[model samples]
Target: MKVRALAGVALLTTMTLTGSPATAGAPTTAAPAHPTAPQQATGLRAVADRAGLRIGTAVDMNALADDAPYRAAVAREFSTVTAENVMKWESTEPQRGVHDWAAADRLIDFARANRQKVRGHTLVWHNQNPAWVNERDLTPAQLRAVLRQHIIDEVTHFKGRVWHWDVVNEVFNDDGTWRDTIWLRNLGQGYVADAFRWAHQADPQAKLFLNDYNNEGVSAKSDAYYALVKQLKAAGVPVHGYGVQGHLAVQYGVPGDTLTNLRRFERLGLQTAFTEVDVRMPLPADPIKVQAQAQGFTALLQACLLADRCVSYTLWGFTDRYSWVPGVFDGEGSATPLDENLTPKPAYAALRDTLAIAAR
Candidate 1:
């Protein structure tokens, strides 16, 4: 997924908490420290266990495999896990009719070992699709058939294991227009409905969601989703959830109407989630920037907690060690709660404080 700042956004951007002692390869100038060991009573998962919500983070499979501290933090902090990339179409099916489930299976197994639920990210999206699924090469009928099969097969393979499937992702652009991707160009907007139905058929027990960024607050994009959800409901489509990819930046500030937006969706009989959350700032961090970042992280979380049926709050990645932000957005990093050395930041503290209060 590409990272681009929202247009006409001011660059600027919360929480309190303690930190664990820095480990090997720690940055020379560390973030202000918090007492993480004493705060173990309020580990994100521990507090979230009582808050009636699942706290999750996207897992970088390689880090889970090779980085001990990273692996440990993932298991300790989150109640659920989302694959950062491995479960996407390109990674899962590199070639036509050839599927690779090893990496995804490993994540599922890890989640099970830790008694965490797996959130199956993205059965359908414009990005990270396999190279073979060419727009110019396949006709609409052929494309539709392939997409249906992919959803069914992928969902079926993980049926009882996955708690939620982002069945269709980023189908609409920031302005509420259908993104001119292969699915929309070929199968039309009905592809969203078809993807959800196919996923439901494959895993009747799994919750299905439509996910997108820049739609966190009520706007043209969310309005479009509201209308689509209504239409799908009227037509008896099996869409179950609306996902707000809470990918905020300090410069953009947090959306003020997030709760209002979420409430409207809940009233429509759908669950809501703050998926893919991370608040990045301009590099060379300072006190003000980090403080704003914490607020950005907590604002979305507060909306989820306040909403009647917002089921989960998931960090795009829990630690900066494997963050996709720096690479994608030059001069911007430290998007996750933990820093690169796996030390907790103020953002981590803020989340802990928020969840701790909810737990109480």
Candidate 2:
């Protein structure tokens, strides 16, 4: 959360086809006119139009904040933007004493002006905390209060704007054990409950999502989330969706059991979204490896498209230029399907092609 583009970076920054349209050229001043009726085939938008799907691109808030050209670049690739990093507690309230809403504000503003729907980054995550929220040695009760107030201030701060907020993030680890987050330590399990309640009070319309990475396949983490969601639903928490952050690796391959995991959650009547979707190839962009990675993207897209309640599918960030992979992954972070300067990579074209075929 709070993914910032290093200022002065050339700026920001796509793939896969389950039915995504092709963004073939540079995003232009004029959007093309739409056909009155649905086509058998076309690009990402077309696929969505015919099938009623949501295709989105994640973007950096700072890119939209002070940089016009960068903003234009992003506005070109995506019609829907998930504030890539902004909106988290750390970025918004880095110095605890001060509340810096300007960044998140601009992102929300950009999405609104563009007629783009936004997925609010997060509300309760152990990472990206304001220094002051936990700086002092507060007791469990005091910490609980901090958590509640944080949910209120943050949720109310952008009420009615964002369509969905990742209310709680990565609470379960790969092993199905609860992550040792400060929220867990101080506020106990009830914090998750209270976050949803406070968020509901702040903006009843905004859908609340429990977001996590690497839950694409049925694993311990997915099981843990599944159990927690059942409990939350039984307890009347306002959780409406699941954010399957698609940070998958090409080596492992998308598991066969993911469909089962997805179906189980949908049975609970919750919408699912492929939140931070990106499948990374192992290394030096070999053509073969790239092809496998492209296939991986196709697999992920297919999963989302087929899942009954999967509402949307979004690539984490569009191009290699702006991806967090290089910053986070050591070997070579060429997981993205778009190249620098935002050209349509093979992955992008392949997805568009898939969408076209589906429409037909």
Candidate 3:
């Protein structure tokens, strides 16, 4: 019995170290499979199936069209997909009244082919509004009409295709106050409920969500959402989900109370999702940072797993090759489960192992 136990311990250690650091931009060989980590061969979507969780990743349209490997990885790895930019207001309607659904349509079709559900990113956001939408030229009444029309038209176009619509995005600040935007400046706080109503009217079946970052834990931001959900539910608003953008940095440790925060919203009769998760670290990554990043990714996944109503956990992007972090954040990058060469990092192993254990 002692010898058998020692053999099992040796096997576990080998599997754990299999995904350890390799030379930058070079593919690291996949770890040898074991009973607990089946995802190396089965892919995340397969393991996630047993657990009834929607494993997803944000899809970059340009990369999807241009890179064969990227396209394959997206189809094989995720059971749900969100357009990284194509579904946003500016991309969908760059020129006033001239909507371009080519890119967005292609994405939807891809998701359909892969049997993946689509998450319509946002119907309303202060940033990424088209050039024609503004307070400088249009009156408040005109702005309100335009906002309503935008929500209705967009939702109507994608009606049955979208699984969830982020009806409003980043409407609150860190301190739990409303952020100033064209919608707020012209329409007032009631615009939120109005947006939800407009979306529900267009697609009564699609779930509507309020999405934001920095609300993974019970902070002032989440408190504002909690209050808003209660008010919306009280008034019979169509809000159905709470979206936590799980963007974590190694410098700032993962929140310990994420599961607690998720449960509070779940109790309100709303499905919850980690909509945009990625764990970034400083450049010139080392073994310590790699391990820490894995923990950060699994931390969010574990919370979603434990919460009864947490339906999905989606990565912002799954590969460092096309990650948005380095372009946006000056000094930090490597914010994905896979390296630039499409090698699975330790984070990938961690997520797979967590899902495997949960399945059992």
Candidate 4:
């Protein structure tokens, strides 16, 4: 998830913080009444399978071991998995040259055991860097060497296990300017292309993606990605996909041009995905808010279904019990398909209905 300073007010402020699902609140005037019975709880993976796409969720290592029900739900509902944090630079290599694969390896093993594919969370990001990456004060050439080695070693370790790698994450500011992260400060914009290239060299079969939030619709941020992707494609950078982190808030309503935005990326011959979908609502979620959240989730799924090149829909997390929203944002949460008790919510049913229609 991309963590940035909160901006705007009401809807926009909520949107800036990141993503999740909803609960059973009062129905808004536009929303359909909550279904008394949410179908047969047909797993999302089954519905997605019928539509020729994958439904996935981010997983934490501790959840796999400590929460039997959560693990069961993951295997039962999702066809793909992404490590929430274990694959990031800070988690994988906390110290110089000392790689830690224990947590990440467990996720890959679990995915394989359940006949699911793994999407490596990230290979390069502006956040979650180990202290040494910046504290060492390395020269441009030295920093570039460090980045190349990190991508190569990490991608090589996973090899055939991962189906997709988020080669570069959240590289552009909301205004479309390149973010001045350590990578940009040290190696400039070329680092983005180099990161994708090195990852491809390490894992030829793995699909590479540039992942970010607030790019679910046509905007300055997404426009920046479009230009960069065009350049990368012309140069044969091996970028196979573009990720739209669908971290929405009901207060703002869904982005009207989400499908249009995704289709544009498809025209560039890149696969698009709702990489981190979660429709959060303000605290004390009323029925109106829940209904809106359900509508938001349905719209997003419909958008993905409409886009031929959109290959997957992945939630940041599935259940509200372990959601990352409340910890990060005050007076906001309940952004997942399942409530704290692991029962399917209105959003889950909305997703099912959308997938069912698409499957037909």
Candidate 5:
């Protein structure tokens, strides 16, 4: 899951409840000063529990296997997990019929062992696609068949294990037009509906979602999703959710009217989630920028809490050490609630405070 800002467009993009006090080790500068004994919630999972939402993070097989602390942190903090890439098209079916399930199976096994729900990262996406999919110029009918089969096989494989599936991801451009990916180029916009249908057929119990970034706010991208979701519901498409990837940057400022946008989707009888949230700042993160990042993080959680149908809040990854921001966005890192050393940052405290207040 390399989270990049939507290209060729600029777009702008939480909760409170109380529980036990947050743990110590949070940066004093980032943490709020307490008058009495500093009472803080235990962890994100605890905070989310107070607000009736699930807290999750993306995980990779390597991290689970190699990093003891990472695995412990994930198990301790999150109640749900999304595979960063194991379930993506490129990783699942690089050779078309020759499907691979090793990595995905490991993730599922780990989640089961840890008592965490699993969210299948994606069933369809333009990026990280296998070359074989495009290199062989198949007819519209052939490509459609291929797409349908892929969804059916993948969803069926994970069937009862997955709680949600990102049935289609990043399909719309920032300006509300469909991205001319292989799916759109060959199967047209019809592929979106078809993808959701196929996934639902394979596993009716699993929630199906259309996930994307740049739609966190009330913008053209979100408007496009709103119209698409309405049309899908009218046509009896089994679309279950809309995933607003909360990938923010302090420099760009938090998105406006996010709660309103999420509520509109909920009105369509669809569940909503902060699918992939991370607030990145430029390198050598100073107090001012870090504080701003904390504010941005708290705002997202607050918006989710305000939305009735927003069921889950998932960070892209929990710790900065494994964040995809630095690799993708030069000079930008520290995008998660935990720092590289797995220490809670100000954003973590802010989240705890927000959830605590919301619970009250």
Candidate 6:
């Protein structure tokens, strides 16, 4: 655990109690420029001590095959991890007849070896699914069987290792109504309840959450999610929390409204999380704009700290080098609190300061 405490490697040799420092052998050796060992980053524990925040990173398993910079960055930058894409249904189970866990297995392995917490991405969503899962081709009865089997097999596969599962993702539309996805269209409302129940049956200990992209702020979308959760809980479903994906833009609704919705979710006896937090900003960011972005992170963290049920806060990506914003948004932007070079931006410091302040 103490091997990679810094960028360079250091060796420890035990000595007899009566031995003096003069008895030690050569302590100097050529070391790697970047820290690839865990013991090296323990040296960064000083920085973390002063920062007082649960810094984390999102790991893309495919990147682990290459992407040295990313690998070194995550190994050195954060102690906690979230699977960047491995846990997605399309990645974990690309074919109906097969469940490929090679990618997800890497994430689970990394988490276990590091003793780190993992936030399992999604079980059900409108996107990131194979075309075969589309209900347009299947009869109602057939679709129900497919959905049931998918949930059961996938959940059972990663039962104890995955601490949290986004059991149902993007279940609601932006207007606060249920989506018209294959699951909803085929199985009706019972499908949503059944997903959570099936996940519980497969892994009774996994914390389940409903995740969405935009509902960061209190609006029609958020209120709709709230009402749906209330209905689910009333029916005694296994729904545990709401994941308000924090992908705030400078132009959208008031950012504080996200916190308002979070607090409201907590009131309903459910946990809350800033599931996919990323404050996007136009490139060549202005000082004021960057501060606003940082403030957004602080606001989200503040909501979590204040809400009794709120537990985890995760950045969409630790660095701007690999965010999904560029693919989804037309214009180029940086969505992460950390700079592309992996340096802590003002937003990062603000996040640290926010947590420190919260701790007090």
Using all chains and alpha carbons, the TM-scores for the candidates as numbered come to: 0.89, 0.84, 0.89, 0.89, 0.87, 0.82
CA lDDT of each candidate? 0.80, 0.69, 0.81, 0.79, 0.78, 0.66
For each of the candidates, the C-alpha root-mean-square deviation to the true structure, in angstroms, is 8.7, 9.5, 8.7, 9.4, 10.0, 13.7
lDDT for each residue of candidate 5 in 1-360, tens digit (9 for 90 to 100): 111122222222432111110111111111111111211257777766666778899875677767777777777788899888778877788897998887788777767776779999788887776667773677778888888899899999999999999999888778899888888888888899989888989999999999988787778888999999999999999999999888888877876688888989999999999888888888889999889888888777777877778888888888988777777776878889999898999998887777666655
Worst 10 residues of 3 by lDDT: 13-22
Clashes of each: 9, 12, 0, 8, 25, 10
- Residue 60, candidate 4: C-alpha displacement in angstroms: 1.6
Which ten residues in a row are the worst by lDDT in model 1? 18-27
| Candidate 1 per-residue lDDT over residues 73-140, each given as its tens digit | 77778889998878888877889899888888888888877878999988998877888898678888
Comparing 1 with 2 on lDDT, the higher-scoring candidate is 1
Q: lDDT tens string, model 6, 19-105?
A: 000011111112233345453423232233333434456665545446666666666556567776666767666777687776676
Native-to-model Cα distance after best TM-score fit, residue 158 in candidate 3, in Å: 0.8
Residue ranges of candidate 4 with Cα displaced over 4 Å:
1-41
| TM accuracy, model 2 | 0.84
After superposition on all CA atoms, how large is the RMSD of candidate 4? 9.4
Model 1 ranges off by over 4 Å? 1-40
List clashing residue pairs in candidate 6. Answer: 2-39, 3-39, 3-40, 4-39, 4-40, 4-41, 5-39, 5-40, 5-41, 6-40
The alpha-carbon lDDT assigned to residue 12 of candidate 3 equals 13
Provide the global lDDT of candidate 3 against the true structure: 0.81
Worst 10 residues of 2 by lDDT: 19-28
Best candidate, lDDT: 3
**On residues 1-360, what C-alpha lDDT tens digit does candidate 2 reach at each position?**
111112221210022111111111111122211212222234455555444556777765544444454566555445567766567777666664466677667666666665667888778887667667773677788878777777788888888888888899888867899889888887778888889999999899999999888677777788899999999999999999988887766666656666567779999989998887776665677787777667666666666666788777788877777777765656756767777665667777766655444444
